[model samples]
Target: MCGIAGILRVHPLGSEVPPPDVAIPESWLDVLDESIKHRGPDGQGRFRDRATRPDGSVVDVAFVHRRLAIIDLACGQQPMVSERGPYPEKPRNGRVAVVFNGCIYNHRELRKELQSAGHKFVTDHSDTEVLIHGWREWGLEIHRHLDGMYAFSIWDHASAGIYSAVDLVGEKPLYTFSDWPRHTLCAFASTIPALARFQRAFGITPRADTHPMGFSDLLAYGFLSDDGSLGYTPIELVRRVSPRSPIGIFATRGSVRPEPCNPDPARLPAFSVRNSESPEAINAGNVEDILNRAVESRLRSDVPTGCFLSGGIDSSLMSILAKKLIGELQTFCVRMPRLEYDESPIAGLVAKHIGSVHQTLDCHGDPSGDVIQLIRQLGLPFGDSSLLPTHWVSRAARDAIGVAISGDGGDELFGGYERYRAAQLLQRFASFLRMVPSMTRYRRREKSRMTRIGRLVQAAKEGGYPALLMIFPPSELRQLASFPGRKPWEDDPRGDSVSQAMRFDILNYLPGDLLTKVDTASMAVALEVRAPFLATEIVRRSMMTPVSALMPHGERKGLLKAVARKYLPDEIVDRPKMGFSIPIGEWFRTDYGGMKQLLLDTLNSADPFPEDILGIRINRTFIARMVEDHMDRRRDHSQRLYMLLVLAIWSDWLRGLSGTIRN
Candidate 1:
C-alpha cells in the first residue's frame, strides 16, 4: 500500500513558454509527499521527467510515492521504472513508470506470464515491477488482468501522457485537481487534504462552485452519490477517479484534457451458475470451493498476515477457511467492555475450534477521542458506527501484522442484513395490509399503530426498500431541509424486490459506506485489509444465486450458513447475526458526556450554521429536541443525531482549514 501524487503541466498554443520551461519545484512535491506520509511509512521515492512530443509541445510530469513495504520488503522501492530498449542489461530511460497502492494477488501469475513472453524483471520480487512491465505489454488493458485492490498512475514517457486507474470496487481512493486558467499545474493525490494543501501552497485559484449537489446527496442519503460521472466533492476543483474507470491525459494542441475511458462491460462480474444447475441443485460444496479460492488468493503477502474474526458468520467463516488453507493463523477480535457489545467469547470458541493463535483488544474508553481521530483520517463525514470498532481492531492487528483479511462484502453478497428480511416481509404482507381499512383519525394511539403500518404499506407499493434502510426518512429529511423531497439514486432494475435491494446496496452502500469505512479505518493504522468475500468470482456467484436460495426459510445468509456448517460447529453456524456495532444509543443516555457537551456547544454556538453546507436550513430546534429525546429515553434518535453531528463536525473542520489556508 502507498500514497501517490504527481503534477503535470500543459501549455496551450501561442503560450509564451512551453510546459518544460515551467518548473514545479521539488519542495512542492515534498509538501505533497509529506501530507500523506501517514498512508505509507516505510520509504519514499520521487521521479521527474520533461518530454517533448512530435509536435514540439512539451509535457512535464513529476511523481512521488510513499512505500508501505508489504511485499519484497527490501527491493519494493517505487516510482518503479520498467526496463527499456534492446540491450536489457544496459540502463536507459524507463519506458513506463508507476506508483501503485494496494496488493495484486495475481502478480506472481502475471510475472511468470510476462517472463515467458520475453519480459525481464530486475527486482528480487515486487508487484510494482510486474505492474510496470504489464503496462508495457498490455497498455491500459493491463487493469483488466489485475485481480486485487489498487489505485495507480503510470507516466508513459514515450507518449508524453499519463494513465491512471482505481480498483474495480474502489477499495482505494484517488483524487485529482486541475488549474486550467493558471496553466501552472494539474495533479492527483490519495486524499482531498493533500490536494487542498497543494492548491493553497501554489496559489491556484479555487474553483467557484463546490458542487452543492454533492452536499445535498449527503444530507439525503448519508453519502455522496455513487454516480462518478458527476463531479462530486466538498471542493469543486477536485474530482474522484471513479471505480473501475481509467483516465488518460495527453498533450494535445499544446494543452491537456482528461479523457475518461469508456467502461468495459466485461470488467463487471457476470453472474453464472456452474453447468446450468438449478438454484436448488447448487449445494454447499460449490460455495465452499469458490470461497476457499478467494481466501487463498488474498493470503498472498510477504509480511505476516491475519484475519479479523468478529464471531459473526462472515468473519468466522473467513477465519476458518484461512486456517484450513494456511496453518496456525493469527486471528484478532475486539472486545467491547459492555457485554452486549462484545463478541470475544464467541470468537474465542471459533479460534479454539480452528486451533489458531488468537488475541482480543479491548475498546472501552471515551469515544469522543476516537470519533475525532476517525473524522480526521477519513477526510469526510462517514456516519457508520462500526467504524469505531473497525478502527480499534485495525490498530491492534497492525501491531502484529501488516495485512489482515476481512469479510466485508459477505453481508451484501449473501443477504445477511436484517433489512433484507424486513423488505421481503413487507413485500410479502403488503397485500394483506392493503385490504385492512385505513385509519382516519390522528390520535396518538392511531398514529402509533396503523399510521406507521400504512406508511410501510405505501413504501412497499412504491418499492422503496432502499429508503427503508435509511437513517432518516425522506419525510423527516424534508422537514429538516428547505428543498422539496428528493429520492436517492436507484440501481439498474432487477427482477425481484429482494434482488433489487441487494443490487442497490452492492452499487451504493457496499462501496460508499462499508468499503469506505474499512479502507479509511484500516489505512489509518497503516494496515492493509483484503476482503476475500469481495473477490470477483465469489461476488458474481453470490449475485447469481436467487435471493430465496440465499435466505431459504427466512434464514438470512442461509447458503453461507449451510457451507459453514461443514467446517464449524452447529452453535456457531446457527447463531443470530450480530453486527460489529457500538452502543451509541445507550451511551447517549448514560455515558458520552463529553460528546454530548460538544454537540450542544456546536448547536448553541454563535457562528451561523451555513445552509449551503448541508444545502438546507437545518431546524436547530428539531435537532436540539432530538438530543433531549435521546437523553430522556423518549426516543432513540442516536443514528439520526449522529449523522447530523458528523456533518456539523466535518463542515466545521473544512471551514477552519479553509480559513487557515487563506490566512
Candidate 2:
C-alpha cells in the first residue's frame, strides 16, 4: 500500500530534474497523504521531476509514494523503475516509473516469463520492480496477465506519457484531479478528506457532486455503477482507463493529449475468464493454482501480515494456506454476543489446528453514538452496517499486525452467495417452464382484462416478482425526489430477481461499498487488508465454471464448501454463514433517539420530495416500528430499517453537496 501523485503539463510547467518550481503543493500533499496514511506508515516519498524541451518547453511530473514495506523490506522502494531492457539501452532514461497500491499475486510467474523473454531484472528487491518491467515488456495489455486487486500509475519517459489502470473489479481505488489548463494533475491516498487540504490550499471549491456526493449515488445502486456519475468531490476525476485500456498523456503545445491505447481484453495473453455455470475447458486446474499464487503474492510485503478468520470455508481455507506460507501468522476474529452470530469457537479451532496466534474481539456494545463520528471520519455518508464491525476488527488488527488477509471476494467469485443459488433455482424453473402458453401470451399483453389476468398468472409463475428487489422498494423510493437514476431493479434486460440483485450487488455494493468500507476503515489505521479470493485470475476462472458447479443443488458456495472440507472440520463446514452482520436495527430503535429525531427533522426540511412520493411519514413510522420490533425480538426488520436509515443519512449528505458541484 502506498500514496502516488503525478503532474503532466501539456506545455512546460517547469525545467530541471526534480523541478523545484513545479513541486506539488506541500500543503496539498500533506492533506492527501495524511488522509491515506492508513495505507502506508513506515515512510513516504514525494518526487517532482521534469524535462526541458528544445524550444525551452518544460514538462513536469510529481510522484508521491508512501511505503508500507512489503516484499523486499530492506530494498523495495517507489516509484520503482525498470532496469535497461533489450531495446531501451538506458531503461532509466526509458522514463517509466510506477507508484502502485495492491499486490500482483502472479508477479513471480510473470517475472519468470519476462525473464524468459529476455527482459532483465536487477532488483531481487520488490514486487513493484516487477510491475515496472512488466508494463514495459507488455505495455497496457499487461493488466490481464496480472491477478489481484490494484490501482497503479506508470509514467513512461520513453513515450513522454503517463499510463494508469485499476483492477477489473475496481477493488483498489484510484482518484485523480486533472486540470489540463494548469498542467496540474494529482492522484491521492483515498477519497475527499485526503484531498481536502488541496481544496484549502488552492481555494478551489472541491467538486462535491463527484466526491462525497458520490456517496448518495452509492445509496441508489448499493454501490458505484460502471457508468454512473462519479462522486461529490472533484476527486472523481480519475475516469477508469479501463482494465486493458492504455492511456497516453502527451505534452502538446497548448494541451495535454490523452489517447486510449484501446487494447481488447479478449486478446490479452495471460487472460483467463470463468463464469458461475462451470469452469471453462481452457481454465481447468487454473483456479487453485491462481488462488494459491494470489495468496502468496500478497505475502510479499515487508511488514508482518495475518488473516481475518471467520471459520467459514473461505476464511478458513485462506487461514490454513496463510499459516502454511507465512510463518507464525496472527489471526484475528470478531465475536458478537449473539450465540448464533459468533464464530470465535470455529475460528479458534482453526487457529489451534493451524498453529497460529489468535485473538478474538468482542463486539458487544453500541455504535449509535459513533455514527456522527464515523460519518465525519469517512468524509462521506455510507450505509453498510458492517462498517462499524469492520472498524472494530481493523483497529484491533492494526495494534497487532500491519497487514491482514481477508476472504471477501470468495462469494462473488465462487458462487458462495445464497442469493445466487436462489437465482439459479429460479432460472432453472424458468427454463423448465419455457413452453407454457399463457406465459408467452402474457409477454404481448399490456393492461387489458385478459392482459391483467394473464400478467397475474405470469407473476404467479415468476413467484411474485417485484419491478426491482431492492432493500428499499421503488414505491417507497418514488418519494425521494432527489433520488438519482432509474429504479435499482429496472434491469436493462429482465432476468431472475435474485440474479439481477446479485449482479447489481457485485458490481455496485461489493466494490463501491463493502470493499470501500474495509479499505477505508482498515487503512484509516494503516492496516493493509488483502483479499486473496479477489485475485482476478481466480475470479475469471470461477466465472468460467458452470454456475451450477458453484452452487450445485442450490447450495450456497458449494465449490467453496468442497474446498473448505479438505482442511476445515465437518462441524465448521456445516455451520451457517452468518456473514458480517450487525445489530444496527436494535440500536436505531431502542438506543438511538437522537438519530431518529435528527433524521426526521433533517428530512422534513426538504419539501420537493412530498410524503406521497417517499411515504415519508409512513416510512418513518415503519422504521421506528421495525426497530421497535427488532429491539423487542419480535421480528427481523433489521435489513429493511437499516436501508431506510442509510437512505436518510445519504439524503442529508446529498442535500449538503448541492451548491458544491453542478448537480
Candidate 3:
C-alpha cells in the first residue's frame, strides 16, 4: 500500500517568460504527499514531467509516491517506471510510469506470462512495475485483466493522457481534481485531507454543490452515500467533477472527459438469486479455493500486515487462512466493558487457534459522543456507530503495522446476515397475506403493519431499505416534519420498492456506509486495510448462488456459513454471527447521561440545521427517551437514536462545510 499524487496538463500553452521551474507548490505537494505516510512508511519518491511549449516554455507534471515496501523491500521504491525497448510493440515499450496503491495478488502469475511473451524487467521490484508493463501491453483494457484491490495512475509519456483506474468494487479510493486549462491535476491519499493540504499550499479554496444523488442514495440504502464526485471535500475556486461511473481517465488538456471502461450496465453481474441446492451439498473445493486465494492476495502488502479478528465466522475464517498465508500473523481485537456487547473472548479463542500474536483493547470509556469530530475528519455524514471502534482498532494496529487485512464485505456477498433470511421470509409473508381479503387484513388489530402499509399507499411513497434500518417510522417522519409532498426518490424509479431498495443501497450505501466507514477510519490513521472478501471475483462468484442458497433455512448468510465450516472446524465456524458492532445499543441505555448531554448541548448551540423543516431534535432528551424506551421494553430504538446522533453531528459538519465552500 502507498500514496500517489500527480498532475496532468493536456495541451501546454505558451507563456511570455519560460514556465516557472516550480509551477505547482512544493509545500502543497509535500503536505498532500505526506498525508498518507502511515500507508507508506518505507520511503517516498516523486517524479516530474514537463511539457515543452512552442517557445521553449514548460509546465510540469509531478507524481509523488510514499512507499510501504511490502513486496520488493530493497528495490521496490515507487514512482516505479518500466525500462524502454523491453516490449517494442507495447504502449509503454518499457516506457510506462505508474504510482500505485494496492496489492496485485496475481502479479506473480502475470509476471510469468509477461516474461514468456518476451517482456523483460529491470528488477523484481514491485507490482508497480507490473502495472506499468500491463498497461503498456493491454491499454485501458488492463482493468478487467487484473484481479486485486487497487487504485492506480499510469502516466504513459507515450499515451500523453494519464490513465487512472480504481478497482472494480472501489475498495481502494482514488480522487481527482483538475480545473486549469493545461495545469493543475491531482490524485492522492484517502480523503479530502490531501486536497485540503494542497489548498493551503496553493492558496486555493474548495467548493461544494449539493448533489441530489447523495440524498436519494441516503434514504434508499442503509449506508453508502456519496454527495457526488466532489464528495464532502469542499473544493472551492475550482471546477469539480461529478461522480461518473467507474472508468479510465485519459486526462490531457483537449480531452478532460472521463471515459467509461466498465461493462454496459445491462451486463453487470447479479447480486442475488434463489438456489434450491442444499448448503451441505454445495461444492466445498471451490469455496476453499476462492477464500484461500483471497487471503493469499491480500498478503501481498509490503508492510507488516495483520488481521482484525471480530470473533465472527468471517473474521475467524479469515484468521485461519491468514495464518497459512503469512506465518505468525499479528491479530487485534476490541473488547467492550459490557458483557452482553463483548466478543473479545471469542475472538481470542480464534486467534489462539491460529497461533497469532493476539492483542486486545478495552474501549469502555466514551470517545465522548465524538461523532461530530469524526464527521469533520471523515469529510462526510456517515451514520454507522461502529466506525468509532473500527477507527480505534485500525489506529492501534497502525502503531505496529502499515497495512492490515480485514473481513469486511463478506456478509454483503455471502448469506451471513440474519436479515437476509428475514427479508426472504418477509417477502413470502407479504405474498401470503396478500391472498387474504383486503378488508380482513385491514380489520386485524396489528397496528404496526397496518400503519406501515397505509404510509406506503401513496404512489409517490417509496420505502425499502429505510424500512429495514429506519429509526423512525414513515408515519413518525411525517409526524416529525411536514414536507410539501412525498419524500424525494430521484434515484428510485417511480417508487418501485424492491428496485428502489436495491438501487439505493448498491449505488449509495455500499459506497457510503460500509465502504466509507472502513476507508476513512482505516486511512485516518494512515493504515492501508484491504477487504479480500469484496474482490470482484468473489462478488461475481457468490452472485451465482441462488437466493434460496443465500439464506439457507432461515439463517442469514446461510450459504456462507456452510462454506466457512468446510474450511474451518465447526467450533470456529458455527458460532452465531456477530457484526463488528460497538456497544452503542447498550451504551445508549445504561450510559445515556453523557451522550444525552452532548446531543442536547450541541443542538442548543449555533447549529444551522433546518430543524423547523426537518423536525428531529437530536438532543439529550431524545437519547434519554430512547434509553428509557429500551429499558422499559417499549421499543427497540437504540440504532435509530444512534443514527439521529450521527445526523446531528452530520448536520453540524455540513454547516461548517458551507462556510468553507462559500469562503
Candidate 4:
C-alpha cells in the first residue's frame, strides 16, 4: 500500500501566467508528498516529465509515490515506468508510467496470462508490473481482469491520456481536482489536502463556499456530499473517484473513474427463491467457496499479516478460515478497559480454538490528544468515533505486521445490521409514527436502544432509512447550529425494503462511513487492512440471497451464522455482535481522561473555525449549553458533542492549511 500524488495538465486555468506552455513546478509535489508520508514509510519516488502536444500547449505529467514494500520488496518502487505497451498506435509522448496504492491479489495470474500473450515483465513479482502489462493488453478493460483493493493512475505516454481507477468497493481512494477548461484533469492525490496544497502552489483563488452542500449534511449523514465527491471547498476542485465515473479525456488528467467492469450490480443476482432451508443450503457452499478464495488471495502478501479478531461472526469466521488455510496465523484484538465495550475474552476463545498466536493490546488510555492527531489525518472531515479504537488496534498491529485482515464487509455485504429489520418495522408503523411528529419534535431521547430506535422511526418520517441513521435531526441541527438541512434522501425504489436497506449500506454507509474510518485509521499508521468479505464474487453472491433467507426467523446475518456453524461452536457463532467501540459518551460527562477539557480547548480557541464555517455563526450559546448538560450528567449528548468536536478540530485544521497556503 502507498500514498500517490501527481499533477497533470496544469495549464493557465488557475495559474497567474498566461498559458500555452506554463506547467506546475515539480517542487509542488514535495508538499503533496509530505502530507501523507505515514501512508508509505518504506521509501519514496518521484517522476516528472513534460510533453508538448501538437497544438503547442505543453502538457506536464508528474507523479510522486511513497512505497510500503509489500509485494516486491526490492523492485516495487513506483512512479514505475514501462518502456512502452505494444498496443498504442499513436505517437508516444513518453513511457507508460503508473503510481499505485493497494494490493493486486490476482497479479500473478494476470502476469502469467500476459506473458503467454508475449508480454515480458521486468520485475520478478511486482504486482505493479501486471497493471502496466494489463493496461497494454486491456486498456480501459483492465479493471475486469484483476481483484484486490486499489487506487491507481496510469500516465500513458502512449495515448498522452491518463487512466485511473479505484477498486470496485472503493477500498482505496483517489481524489481529483478538476476545474480546468474542457474538463482538464489538473491534480489528483490520495487525500484532499494534497490536492489543495498543490492548488495553493499555483496561487489559485480559494472558495468561500466551505460548506457547499451545507454543514448539516455532515451532521446528518457524516458527509457533505453524495457518492462522487466530498463537500470539499474546492481550492480547485475535489471529487473522490467512486465506481460511478468512467475514464475520460486529458489535459494532464487521470480519471480514476471505475468502469462497470465487475458483474452487473444493477440487478441483484437471483437466488433459488425456494421455501426455507433450500436457498440457505444452496448458497452456503457458494459463499464459502467464493469467500475462501478471497481470503487466500489476501494472504499472498510478501510481508507478515495478521487478523483483527473481534470475536464477532465476521472476524471469527475470517480468523478461523485464515487459520484453517495457513495452519498458523497471528490474530490481534483491542481489549477495551470498559467491560461493555470489551470483546477480547471472546476473541481469545476463538484464537485458542483456531490455534493461532493471539495477542490483546490494551486500549485503555485517554485518546484526548490522540484523537486530535487522528482527525488531522483524515483527508476529509469524518464524524465516526470508532476511528479512535480502529486507529489504536491498527497501531498495535503495525508493531507486528504490515497487513491486517479485517471482517469489515460482512455486516454490509450480508444483512448483519438491526437497521435493516428496524426499517421494515418502521415501514409498517410509518403511518402511526408520522401522526406523532409533534411528540417526536420534543422527544430528544437517545439513551436506550429503544429510545434510539424511537428517534430513528421519528426521523424516518422526514426522510427515509438515511434519515434513520442521522446524527442530528433537521430541526435540532437548525436550532443548535445555523447549518441548513440537505436534500431529503429518497429511498431506493428497486428492491424489497430489507434488500434496499442492505444495498443502501453497501453503496452508501459502508463506503461513506465504515470504509472511510477503516482506510483512514489503518493507513494513518501505514498498515494495510484487507476485507475479504467485500471481494467482488462474495458481494455479487451475497446480494443474490433473499433477505428472508439471509435472515431467517428475524435473525440478522442468519445465513452467515449458518455458514460459520460449519467451523465454529454455537458459543462463538451465536454471541452478540460487540462492535469495536469506545465509551466516549460516558467520557464526555466525566471528562474522562481529559476528553471534555480537550474539547473545550479546541472549541474555545480564539475563533478556531472561520466565523463563517461553524454554521455561518456557530451558536456558541447552544454548544455551551449542551456541554454543560452532558458534563453535569443531565443528558447523553455524547454522540452530538463528539461529532461537533471532530468537525471543530477538522475545520480548524483546514483553516490552518488555508492560512499557510495563502501566506
Candidate 5:
C-alpha cells in the first residue's frame, strides 16, 4: 500500500568510530522516492537528520515515504513523527519517524490500548501513529503485538538506530543493501531496484554478481527466496530482513541484522509447526471464527473495497463474509479465452449469491509481451505464470476500488496443492521405490510424471527434499548450470510427508513464490490486495491442525472445504482447483503460437545470461534440446521453459539498468 526507503550509517559498537557524513542529500532521497512512485501515488514525505549514539558514534539517517492514503486519508501521510512525549525541544531530534508499506489491520485495537495507557491521540485513526506509539511502548517487540501485513522501518531517535520488521508470515517484503563490512551502513526499501540505485550513492558500484544460493533457488524452484540462505540476497551486497525476526542496528536496536537470532530463512520464526503424534484436535468452529475476524479486518479500508471472487472456496467464502459485514460489496473476475483456465462463470454465481456488484472483464492480451513486462516491472526474476491474470484483474479493479480481498495463502495453509498429496504417496512407497533401482536409460525429452516422481523420491531420500518442488531437478541442473548452487532446505520439519510438505510450503513457497506473485502483480497497478487466510491466528490454527484435517483421505484442502460448505454451495466448494492458471503449455503447442514464437525468439538469442555474472549460465546446447523436444511434441516442458524465459527476460532487463528505474 506504500513505498518506503531510507539510508542508515552508524559505526558498529566497540569498533573504531568514524565521523559519519551528517549531510543528508535531498537529491538521493529524490531518486529513492521516484523509483517506487507507482507503489504510492497519493503523496510523498521525507525526513533527514542525524543523532549521536550512546557509544559516541554519530548516525546519519534519511527516510522517504510515498503514501497511497488507504486509511485516515487526511492524517496518514507518513515519514510520520511521534510528537506525544516531552523530550528534546528541537522537534526533529529524538523523534521516531516511520516509513511503512502494507496495512495494519489491528491498529484500532492497539490504539485503544495505547490511549488508555496515556498516549494522546492526534490523528482520528492512523495506523502509522500506532506504530510510533507501539514502538515507544514495546520497542522491538512491537512486531509481535501487531497483526498485519507490513514491512516497516522506525528511525529510533532514542537509540540513534533503525528498527525494522516484516509481517510474521512474510506477506510484505523489505530489501536491503548493507556495506557493513566496509562501513557500518545499510540502505533499505520496498523493492530491490531502489537499493540497486542507492548503491551508487553509497560509493559502491552496482554489480549483478548473482548470489550463488539465489541462482540456485531460482532453478531449484520457479522463484528466488526473498529471505536468503545466509541473509544474503540475489545480489551479493544486498540482503533481506527475514520475516518475524525483528532486526535492527546500533546498541539498543535488539538483535541487529548481522547477528540475527536465527540465520535460517527457510523455517518459521516466533512460531514454527511443532511435530507431534496424534497432534491435539483442532476446533472447526474456532477456525471459522478466526477466518471471520480475518475477513472482517481486511474490510477496514477507508476507500471503496471489493473482493476478488474467483468462485473457489477461499474467495467465495471471503466474499460472503465481507458482504455480511458491509451489507454490499463490489466483486470482480477475469474471464480468460481458455475455458479450462477460466473461473468467471462460477465467479458470477458466487457474486449473485452474495448480491454484490460484480463485473467480469474479458482478459485477453499478448501473453508473451505481458510476461516480459511483468518480469521487468517486478524488479525481480519471478516465474509464476499466474501473474498475468493477477495483474490484469488488479489493473481493472484499481479503477473501482482501492483494495481487494484476495484468496491467496489458502492453498499453502490448507494443503490445497497436489504436491501435498504427492508427499502422501511418497511416504507410503518411498522406501519400496528406493529398493527398485531408478531406470538409467530414458527416451529423449521431458520425463513422464511417473519418471519425475521417481526422481523426486530419490532426491527426497538423499536430503534434497526441495527438489520435489524444483523448476529443474538437480540431476538436470548439474548438467545445465555453469555454476551450481547449494541446496537450501535445512531443518526439514519433523512430521509425516504431507505435514512436512505443508510446512515447507508455508515457510518457503507461500512467501517466496505465491505471495510475491500477488504482491508484485497487484502493486504494479497500485492496487492493494489483502489475504485474509494469512492472518496470524488463522495461520497458527492451520499449522496446529493435524495433516488429516487439512487433507482427509488424500483430499486436498479438505478442512477449508468443510468450512466453505457452510457458506458456499457444494458445487462451488467441490469444484476442481483451477484459478488464474495459464495454458502456456497448450499455447506453445496449439494455435496460440504467438507465445511459442516469442519464447523461441527471446531464449534462442546468442547468449541468454551474462557469462561474467554469478547467475546460472545457460548452456544453449541443453536448452535447445528441450526446445526441440517440446516443439516436436515429444515433451511438455511448459514450466521449465517458462522459468528460462523469465530468467532471460530478467537478464535482458538487468543489462539495461540505466538512470531510470522501470516500474
Candidate 6:
C-alpha cells in the first residue's frame, strides 16, 4: 500500500508559448507528498518528465510516490522507471514512469512470465518492478492481467501520454482533478486530502460549483451517485477513476481529450455456473480450494500478517484457511461491552478451535472520537457506523501486524446479509402482492417499524424497489431535503429481485460503504488489509453460482455454510449472522448524550446549511423529531440519525478546513 499523486500539463496547438521553467512547483509537490505521508511512511520518490509537442508546445508530468515497504522492503522504491529499452536516465523527450498504490497478488506469476519473455528485472523482488515491466510488455493490456487491488498511473514519455487504471473491484481508490480551462494541469491522487492540499498550495481554485444533485443523492442514499453510478466523491471538482476503467491522456500538438481504454469483456474473467452439475459437485473441497488459493495469494506480504476474526462465518472461514497457510496465525477481534454488539466470545471460540494466537481488545471510548477522525481521514461523508469498530480493530491489529486479511466481500459473494433473504422472500410473494387490489392505498403510518408486507406494498406502489439497504427511506429523505426525490436506480436492469439486490449491493453498497470503511480505517493506521473473499476467482465463482445454491430454502449463505461444515463445527457453521455493529441508538439515549448534543448544535447552528456545504434547507423540525423519537425510545432512528450526524460532522469539518485555508 502507498500514496501516489501526479500532475500532467497539456499544451494546445498553435500556441508558441515558452515552456514554463517549473511546470509543477517544488513547493506544491512537497505539499502533495507530505499530505499523504500517513499512507506510506517508509520512503518517498519523485519523477519528472518534460516533453515538447510536435507544434513546439511543451507538456510536463510529475509523479510523487510514498512507499509503505510491505513487499521487497529494500528494492520496492517506487516512481519506478523502465530502463530495459532505449530509455535514457533523464530522457529529454519522454520516459516511462509508474506510481502505484495497492498490492498485485499475481505479481510473482506475472514476474515469471515476463522473465521467460526476456524482460530482465533489476530488483530482486518488487511488485512495483513487475508493473514497470508489465507495462512495457503489455501496455494498457497490463490491467487485464493483474489480479489484485490497485490504482496506478503510468507515464509514457515517447507519446507524452499518461495511462491510469484502478483495480476491477475498486478496492483501491483513485481521484482525479482536471483543470481543462486553464489547460495547465490534470492531477490524480490516492486520497482527496492530497488533492485539496495540492490545490491550496498551487493556488488552483476549483471552477465547478458544488454538485447539488450529489448532495441530494448523499442525503437520500447515504452516498453520492451521479446518474445511478456510485463512484462520485462529495467534491464536484474531483472525479473518481471508475473501477475497471483504464483512461489515457495524450498531449498532442492539437487539442485533445482523454481516451478510454475500455477492457475487452472477452479478455476479462466471466462468471458462469454449470447448471447441469449437482450441488454435490460444487462441494466443500472445491470451495476450499478456491478460498485456499485466495488466502495463499494474499499471504505473500513480506511483513507480519494476521487475520481479523469477527467470529462470523466469513471471518472464521478465513481464519481457518489462514492458520493452515501460516502456522500459528495472529488473530485480532474487537469486543464490545454491550452484549448485543459484541462478538468477541464467538471470535474467541473460533480462535480456540483453530488453536491460533488470539487477542481481543475491548471497544471503549466515545465512538464519536473515532468518527470525527475517520471523517477527517476519509475527506468525505461516509455514514457507515461499522467504521467505529473497524477502526478500533484495525488499530489493534496494526499493533501486532502490518498486514491483515479480512473477510469483507463474503456477504456480497455468499448472500450473507439478511436483506438478501428478505429480497428473496419479497420476490416469492411479488405475484400474490400484484393481485391484491388497493394495496397501494395502504399507507405505512409507522416510520420506524415497517413490516415486510408494508415494504413490499410500498415498493410495488412506488413503481420501483426500495434500496435493499438504506440509511433513510425515500419518503423520509423527501421530508428532510428541499430537493425533489429521484430514483437513481430507476433505469437499472431488472432481474431476479434477490439477484438485482445482490448486484446492487456488489456494485454500489459493497464498494461505496463496506470497502470504503475498511480501506479508510485500516489505511489510517498504515495497516494493509487484503480481502481474500474479494479475490477475482472467488468473486467470479460467487457471481456465477446459482442464487439457489447460495441461498437454498431461505437459508442465508447456504453454500458458504455447506463449505464451512467441512472445516468448522456444526455450531459455528450454523450460527446466526450477527453483524459487526454498534449500539448507536442506545448510545444516543444514554452513553453518548454529547453526540446528540453535537448533532443538535450543528443542525441548529446559524451557518449549519451553508450554501457550499449542503446547498439546501434542512428541515429542522423533522431532524428535531428524529432526535426526540430516538432519545425518548419511541423509534429506533439510529441509522437515519447517524447518517444525518455524519453529514453534519463532515460539513462542519469541511467548513473549518475552508476557514483555515482562507486564514
lDDT of 3 by residue, 1-663 (tens): 666777654443343423433565566567777666655667898876654433333334667887766677777778886657465755466456788887787888788787786777777656766786687667766776677767787766555556667665566666666554433344444545565456556555443333333332332233544444434332332222222344444544433443444433322343332233634222344667777888888777656888889888878778888888778889998887667668899899878777989999767434554566566665544667778888888878878877787888776666555444334334435445334433312412212565334323321233423444444444344333322223533433332233234433444555557777887677566687878787666766565555445555656666667766655677767776656776565555455427656644544555534343123332445445555665565665555556656655655554444444211
- Worst lDDT 10-window in candidate 2: 267-276
Error of 4 at 369 (Å): 1.7
Relative to the unseen true structure, what is the C-alpha lDDT of residue 245 in candidate 4, on a scale of 0 to 100? 42
* lDDT (Cα) of model 4: 0.73
For model 4, state the Cα shift of residue 609 in Å: 3.2
Each prediction's number of clashing residue pairs: 0, 39, 32, 4, 0, 2
The predicted structure with the larger TM-score, 2 or 3, is: 3
Where in model 2 is the C-alpha error above 4 Å? 12-24, 52-57, 81-86, 89-93, 115-122, 180-189, 210-217, 228-248, 257-291, 325-328, 352-355, 364-378, 424-469, 482-506, 592-663
C-alpha RMSD for every candidate = 4.2, 7.5, 6.2, 4.0, 4.3, 3.8
Q: Model 4, which residues run further than 4 Å from truth?
A: 10-22, 87-94, 179-185, 205-214, 229-236, 252-282, 364-366, 437-447, 612-615, 660-663
Tens digit of lDDT per residue, candidate 5, span 432-508? Answer: 75576654233233336655656656555543456667767666676677546455344434566766777677878
- Model 6, range 1-663, lDDT digits (tens) per residue? 999998887666665544443557778788788877888989999988787776666787889999888999888898998744423442322357899999999999999998987777888889988887787777768887888999999888777878888876678988877665664577888888777667666675432234555665566567544232124567645677766467776765554345466544442233333232644233344877888899999999889999999999999989999998889899999988689778899899999999989999988645767787778777777777888889888887888999998999988877787766556655666567546553322322223234445556545434344443656556666788756665434423335666667766776677777877888888888999999988877765666666776777767888778877877899888888878888777776665736666666666676655656455667878888878876776666777778877877776766665553311
List the pairs of residues colliding in candidate 5.
none
TM-score, one value per model:
0.89, 0.77, 0.78, 0.90, 0.89, 0.90
For model 2, how does the per-residue alpha-carbon lDDT over 394-427 read when each residue is reduced to its tens digit?
Answer: 8888887888999887876665665454344444
Cα-lDDT of candidate 6:
0.73
**Scored by CA lDDT, what does every candidate get?**
0.74, 0.59, 0.59, 0.73, 0.74, 0.73
Write the residue-wise lDDT of candidate 4 on 1-663 in tens digits: 899987776343334433323455556777888976889999999887665454444567788999888998998999899876554563432378999999999898889999998787999999999998888887777887778889898887645557777776678877777655444446778877677666667665433344535445666666533444232332336666765443433653322222223232332343333233544332655767777899999888888999999999999899988987888799999998689989999999989888989999998645897778877776455777898899899988999999999999898877888777677866667777766644442334454665665676666666767777777777667776555666655545455678777777777788778888898888888999999987766766676666776787878988789888988899888887767778888776567778878888876777655654333666777888887876766666777888888877776766676663311
Residue-wise C-alpha lDDT for candidate 1, range 424-516, written one tens digit per residue: 666667677556654323212212455455546545543356665556556566566644555533434335567767777887788778888
